[model samples]
Target: MPDIKDPLFQPYSLGSLQLPNRVVMPPMTRSRASQPGDVPNALMAEYYAQRASAGLIVSEGTWISPLGKGYAWTPGIHTPAQVAGWRQVTEAVHAACGRIYAQLWHVGRLSHTSLLGGQAPVSSSAIQAEGVNVFVAENDGTPGFVQASRPRALDKAEIRAIVDEYRQASRNAVAAGFDGVELHAANGYLANQFIDSNANDRTDEYGGSLENRLRFLDEVARALVEGVGDASRVGIRLAPLTTLNGCADADPETTYLAAAKLLGEIGVGYLHIAEADWDDAPLMPVAFKERLRTAFPGTLIYAGHYTAERAREAVARGWADLIGFGRPFVANPDLPERLRIGAPLNEHDRATLFGGEARGLIDYPALEAAEA
Candidate 1:
């Protein structure tokens, strides 16, 4: 084959690290973490190591505390066992010469009482996400999902504690041997719930206007930086125009643009935008993307139904610094290599997308193995 000079293969610099390609493995919840303690294990380690060829690996969203969990079998970073469990995962990825970032997450109101010790979910407001649901373990040891419970608005004290939890999680991530950490502020999670006006009805300092709504996000970013002691190792994911998990704002463009500028000023390493991924999902306007490119001075990464051709075009236009592949990385461990060589990709099996063993996680055949 002739030499492939794709921009996706070109090296790029993100903060203090240099990337070999612009392909990123974005955070995807497989719901396969070890049960009982929601700890990372050798299975998760092998799964990530198999896809270490990506320019960057953003680990699945990890709950920072018991209250942060919204799903069954997802990992956490708060406890000693959980930290040690992640140590093995980080070691495995590093052994393969891969760079990985831990995505710190708190699901907030998008949770069930069953998942939260029968306690009401907490959010910026008392409103429950109308149609949102969370995965939980059933009596038979099988995974099942339940609708989110009505949430109580968090007071200032509780909000402060949550910020501290984020800081602690960042410290734990470093101790666990991660290269960096990404704040899960997207997809109507806690941070996004705070950002979206409809979900946040507080009249206090944390609510009312745009600046107030952005306060939580700012505090979390600052806390992560303080914990990691370096803004270069910190990244954040946002969903500006997404209504996923029932998060919607009247003026999404303005709300997110201000946030982009604020994050840029904070000197974060990168800004990841998770565009609506479902089929018939609202398309992210080009004008908004252009504005985002200008507003956020750090490296920009975008994910959502991207193809090789579309990714190439995105980079060619200076729109994205990296293209995150969620499902592609799931089915193609050696996705960057396959893209480079124009090899056929393995189709993802939706049946095994979540809560499975190695059948769909680490067993995807690489091109070399497939040909052999």
Candidate 2:
């Protein structure tokens, strides 16, 4: 038999951590946490533990502070209870021979006061982010997604506070028995708010030049590094050039490359990038991908609609160090096993994506079930 060991299934080193393979399970939002605030629970622990076969599991975008959450039912790391809850999750994943990292996040202006315990969501500027908030369907039969939330302009002090929140959140992640943390800089969130000139119109030093715009990202990176040890332990997620979801940067490639170079200089552990479109949309422009890959010398993980074959090509061609599977992992808990043998993937049910019980969350039958 020909040797089946490929880069995707081969062990590699990311910073100081050694992983079982180059295949990664990107952070996915499973809104199964407790209400009021999305505190972690036993359900979440079991969910992650079941999928521990991946090389690395970057946990879902966990809110760093109360105002950091845009949607309801997402987990947070600001409170002691939340940290304790995450400890259970990490313990379970560890027992399953999995390595996990908490992806720290802040939604910025993506949220409304109505959702943040009646406190307006804060952002770099007062501009409203143009997008719909995803929420779990209520008892009503209609599909419901909350409208764009009102945002309050943040002052210099508030901006500093935001950075501090991330730092503390990183600390919480470390205390929770996790291996590391990945800053949620993607998907039009806080750091994205600063990077997007449309949302950032401040007259202060934190605005105008690209350097000023990326200051928040750099500061957060520094804080995260301090909270989580070296830069190798702190990764960052970037939705570079995502046109969907109302995210349109003036010059995405230029902006993201500049940011990538900065991250490289800062010595981040790895960069988790959500590729252009991420769906049945456009593939990344060859010119842009080359620039980012060149600037980012460390680990590169690509997400959004990454097929097993494409993942192998990416790693082989040096386009990406690892490929992140989002929906596939959601529908097929043992996605790695399926990909290993070219097995069929279970289609994901959109209705049960957010919050639900074992029905769609954990009930997806494995290959063994199918064989039986």
- The candidate maximizing lDDT is 1
**Runs with alpha carbons beyond 4 Å of true place in candidate 2:** 1-5, 136-143, 278-280
Q: What TM-score does candidate 1 reach?
A: 0.98
lDDT tens digits, residue span 1-372, model 2: 222667688788987788878778888887778755578988889889888989899999899988888766789999988998999999999999999999998988777665576787788887876655655344452335776577888888888898898899999999998889999888788888888666688888888888898999999999999888878998999987775445567877788999999999999989999876444666777577778889988888998777888888888888788889988998787888888889999999988987766777778877898778
Q: Which RMSD does model 2 reach against the true structure?
A: 2.2
Which 10-residue span in candidate 2 carries the lowest summed lDDT? 134-143
Write model 1 residue lDDT over 163-202, tens digit each, in one string.
9999999999999999999999999999999999999989
On TM-score, the leading prediction is 1
Cα distance off (Å), candidate 1, residue 261: 0.5
| Residue pairs with backbone overlap in model 1 | none
